[model samples]
Target chain A: MAVQTIGHAPASSSHKGMSPLRRREAINGYVAILPWFLGFLIFTAGPMVYSAWLTFNSWELITPPRWVGLANFRFLLEDQLFRTALWNTFIYTVVSVPLQLLIALGVALLLNLNIRGTNLYRSLIFLPSQTPVVASAMLWFFIFSPTQGLANAGIGLFGIPPQRWLWDVNLVKPALIAIAVWAFGGAMIIFLAGLQDIPQSLYEAADLDGATPFSKLLNITVPLLTPTIFFNLVIGLIGAFQVFTPVYLMTGGGPGTSSMMMGLLIYRHGFEEFNMGYASLLAWVLFLIVITLTIIQFSLARRWVYYEGDRD
Target chain B: MDTHVSPEVKNLQGQRPLMQDHAADDTTARSRSLVVPRKRRAVVVHLILFAVAAVSLLPLLYMVSTSLKARGREFAYPIEWIPNPAVWRNYLTAVETVEAMTFFANTMIVTTLTLVGGILTASLAAYGFARTRFPGRDFLFMLMLSSLMLPYMVTLIPQFVLFRELGWINTLYPLIVPAFFGGAPFYIFLLRQFFRGLPTDLEDAAKLDGAGFFRIWWTVAMPLAGPALATVAILSILHHWNDFIAPLVYLHTRDNWTLALGIRLFRDQYQVLFNLTMAYAVMMTVPVFTVFFAFQKYFVRGITISGMGGR
Candidate 1:
């Protein structure tokens, strides 16, 4: 009755016509979101469905897509280079994600200190993270060159011998991990924000009871910080799994596929090799691995992640 | 955009005054007795931070120094840490040999369009999801968010085909057009969260004044969403400017390349020329620092507001 009374006229000028208020709102909503809806349909949803089909069909750009069910998947299982790429990428992600998180959290804790010039430190630390990935990848190339690199030059300052970096097969992924860890500023800022969100009263109460700083951190700070830690862990995993540009630009998956990630292999198959079916299959496999990892993380998250009001 | 001071930010606010009080207490305590320990600790903290800053910024310094060093000295043994004769012509030469100006202009066109178009489309969609009352709104929004979980690799192949069929291949159109439609799921979600945080009173007043939906959106919400819009704009610019894969896939012509693509091509063309490639790296890297420094506050605020996994 109130809704009917709120409007001046019926939307369609008939007794059974919808209320002008409801009709107008529905129209406005459709009009407002239509651009993205059409986009979501064409660009995202439509292509996703099509890419699935491409996975089962062998198609180069010029040729008609030929059906070859299961063959693409079979190829992936047997491809030696595919296995190498998977191994290399896993090593990179497993080694780097935890290391990155620890450093970022430590930096965040430092920045959270009630001290002057924290903002300057935050900006300085985060500055490297803002460098375009392509540029950073190129910068690392110079840093990794055995004879003439900054890595060697810096070690020389400490009276240590020069070392071959990414050029050496054994050291390539480690060098990439080291480079990856340097860009932890993004995660650090998130941790800083998370630290700010922890209630100060908890700390003050702990202080009143004469709690040691380290004990307070372990008991209060770490427990309260599980959600942010989980957030970084998930994001870092997704990002690390898709390591591409640096591998492609710096090494070309080289020194015998020592640094090839699944993404670079997929790129090589689809674009460089012109085998779209195999590439799409590889991509789908990558997608599934990421999805499974995410699902596992979420199920695990239930054990540790605490919402502020969850207890309440 | 930080419309709600969550318990954590509130805690931070409370803690600052407490710290200041501690500092005051320290001063009084020093007058009464010993303050040397706390002073020494603060000095140690500063020294540690100084070391980190040097390590963090060294690669950047190397890039710049290499770009400026006299031509052959870039790879000199016992390296020229501070280029002896900081020759600036590498910049001029890198640009000339690579047609980098063309790449820059092309990148600007694509990035600016993406920024303007993305904000408009995403903001409109966000308003629909956040402010308007409609049937199936929650369902539709969930569907939209689900796309965030769908890896771009899954969609990359057919999207390339879509553009190829549209004859947008080897041009900036492939890069620019999708943004005009919806931009990205992340940006749409960010803007939606921003819109949801606005007070209901503004829209209620607009309705009382008989302002229609579009008018209310323009006058009431848009006016108050400057910070959110700016954050989206800056993020979009950064993403588009730094995009490598899209340009690498779509753009085959040197003239159509963006700065990222230009650098990759320049690297291949001068693979062993450390100075030239580093010069290109410097050119690509400098703008990111500029934008980040200028808008660091807005960037931080936006992240805190939306950073809980952007869900």
Candidate 2:
């Protein structure tokens, strides 16, 4: 909208008289933002396009890039490790996204109760989100330390046996999901704001009609809050797909690559193995996964996400 | 996106009784009783919130407790919630043991450089998108937006290879340089929104006075954007402070390591020494928590305002 100000520039003749100043302004803007553009060219965009090129070849850093068109993609078609990573990522994404969203929404609803010490609750809840991911992962690693972990100690009071968390092959993704859920406090705050935006009269009217809290939540709250949910879903989807820090720190995708995520695999191939070409192909595949999922979610959201008072 | 709340609705609200009449009747019947239930509800909410807060704080508490626990006591159970003789040396030893001062210096240098670079580049790019109308400007801005959605991991390998080729491996250059160039689209978008919300009269007046864009930006806009800039600065500082992967990938020498990577050194070197690791963890985490508390009011305000601004 601020562009409207520039669009309100004076006519061509007026512009011509001050051409040097305007040109200077343009150049100043360009110069100021030059670092970012240089970064994009040399780092992000450059690497991205190069990665695409690399995907078509067979190259390691030690040798020249051989002209082997689609070889990596062909390798991907039958790669067992690739298939395992794909499956793990899919399972993690599918299980975690809705679960995290629901937990966040529930927490948000609880926090929105206009209770005493709201700020205390908020800061405490958001603490984990602010904690360094590596530290938190390490903390969880200690907590899930098979025998002497606090998790088993606390829950053992209920007479439940100690179960392997990060150690067990099956429990690895769940361990990651638990960590993911702990960070939901941030998303919860966002959803709480969304909840606040809903007209209070809608709730009051529902209350007058003898709508129970549960009914009102299901009928009024969830439907209207879908837009925020959609936003979180998109961001969360992108985030879940790119999850690497926890995987790197906690398990290192261990139990024999059972928890090996696509991102970790990519990192391993590109950095450790120095198979830049194959890694780029994996990145492309992950990119396609995210892009396609985002598209699908956005398209599907039309049916569910209701924007009150929105004419469009 | 913040559409008008209709005048018709406002007038209708004024006309309607709403719950006013019912509330008056109910108040007459149970004004005294209302206080009891309200108090009870407050008590219940507080109790629940307090419990949740305790649960939320447990890991952090454990981290601190473990930091203070005597060596070999990290795994001791019937869980020693209190360390009988607190190992005060853990803090001193942790700091001295790991070249902590050097890592701290490196982190501060990298973080400060990245922070300064991020703010300058992001603000300028934001101003361009917000106020300029060059050819392909809109397309370029869209490109920037699309790039925001690109999986950052996709660029990691290629960028690393490029940095390796440029002899930037094992240096902070790779970590610091790109940040100056608007490496992050999210912050640029955030600042751009803030700039857009600002009144245009200042810029217009500056133009009339023959002052250029940069002059107006420095003299007018920067002063007005103090809060947004503070938000950007704080987030950037925290981000770089916590970044481990970048430093791990770029830095090879132990002396060159940042605090985050330095902390990881403990885990890598002494996997079984939970006490030392926890002590170092507390040392690393405490400062960040302190920083958060210092900027909390502005940080929360920035988050809410940004969300509202996004609308």
Candidate 3:
């Protein structure tokens, strides 16, 4: 309906003394964007609305759907697994996002020095991030293997005792966090681009002021880099919240549901158990949380994020 | 100004920067003391970078090493950094156990079709948004962008049901069809920025030659967008090659599974045989690594352009 309205409104408005060239352009514009518009309606907006409706009903993919008002949402509130998934996802997001950003920033700073073999170093660092998630998870699984794992062997050199990683309930989330952090190369590359964008004159001006490297980093680099930081932060938060693959493959929210994540929970319910209604409800809850947090971040961003050319 | 200059003068002018660099080098040699600390710092920087790079690559290196190790020795205590007797058989076993050739074929088919569809559709939509104007254009673009924030999980179930109704389940259509429509919103945004940055003078000249909008776009705009198109192609290849969830949700039967799904299945079936699993992982990862290395410049440029959009 919205698509039809927008499509017709443009053509109708063209009749109000609009020139022929402008009318042609308007029509061409609609035609060009038609594919994406159709996709939005079918894959995105339509499914979203259908998902909301399914949340209010019970459908097991066999029988006809039955309306059960507010039942899914009510059960979602009290579901212990849902709460565990939420808390686990929240903790993962809170810890991993900032930690990954910080690591990326540090590596980016080092690479920005333009040292010899900078390209080689950058390529090596970023290669892991390109490793398929399933492969990366398997790699880390071997790395954290308790008996013959490289992790224990490396710790053994330091005289530290062996620890079960993905198997131990207490250690599973932290292990997952470490695996997530290992893929910070993507963020690192973005930060490297951001670092390169800072005008050399700013650093030169700081040099003229006899600024120490630390102070220069504090005043010039960090302030100028805030926008990039904000971008990475938002992207990182959104990604970290929806972390599914590694957890699904490595731990499967195992060792007593210690590592259950929201994405995995949705998958379990919808696909595994054929409980689409409850899965939709859980997904909606996750969506609301992400949206609320994103909004909060944006509001808070005004206080700290620096845009170079902004007047206000 | 150039016309007044003789050939000799022009040659001298060309050499001026080289002469200046020599003079600067002489001064820097004289101030060798000043350069020493800087050189030392450069060494320290190199050392730090090397250490970090090595650590960053350690996991992948370990993966390669384990993949080559004898099966039972994969978890040996004193981890073998280099397997003395390399187990090339593990790769064969991994491939055979999972019927990986079939999966690889499926993956190639999905990836190639998705790449073709994604690039053509996303670039078309991007050209429309960037080069054309219509009522509510900005509103429509913003609406598209805002949809990026919607979690994929919210749409997963409904889409599954929709495709199931269409009898597209256990087929590659669910994974490939949407790509034909619009690909991903992010790709469109990236291409839109690129298309906007291109000059319009050529298009204007084409228009004067009686070229239509579609002709100008195909001959003028798309040709000039080589770097951006390459970027989109590389990203699409990597995405479809690595995508797991979509294929997992849609392709139920083993006959239709992609390489990603097959790798997971390999891991599940051969969980204890870390060597075989590592081999499977390595096999699946090589193509992506090759693509990234070959198009390293475009990949970095694409990311830089995306970051620039935030500004």
Show model 2 residue runs off by greater than 4 Å. Answer: A1-32, A199-216, B1-37, B267-271, B301-311
The numbered model that scores best in TM-score is 3
TM-score of each: 0.90, 0.89, 0.91
- Ranked by TM-score, the better of candidates 1 and 2 is 1
Better of 1 and 3 by lDDT: 3
Candidate 3 residue B46 Cα shift, in angstroms, is: 2.3
CA RMSD for every model? 6.2, 4.6, 7.4
The digit string of per-residue lDDT tens for model 2 on B106-183 reads: 999998998888887798888877776444455566677778778878888888888889999998898888887884
Candidate 3 CAPRI assessment class: acceptable
lDDT of 1 at A103: 88
Candidate 3 chain A: 10-residue stretch with minimal lDDT? A1-10
What overall lDDT goes with each candidate model? 0.80, 0.77, 0.83
**Error at B296, model 3, angstroms:** 0.5
Please give, for residues B1-311, the per-residue lDDT of candidate 3 as tens digits.
01132332223233322333444455545556557887898899898888878887889999999999986788876888899898889899998988799999999999999898888889888998888878888788889888878888889999999999999999999999999987888788888888988988999999999998778878999999998999888777777888889998999999999988876654454356788889999998897788778888997776555431111
Which pairs clash (backbone N, Cα, C closer than 3 Å) in model 2? Answer: A35-B181, A36-B181, A36-B182
Kindly list the per-residue Cα lDDT of model 1 for residues A47-90, writing each as its tens digit: 87788898899999898999999898888789999999999989
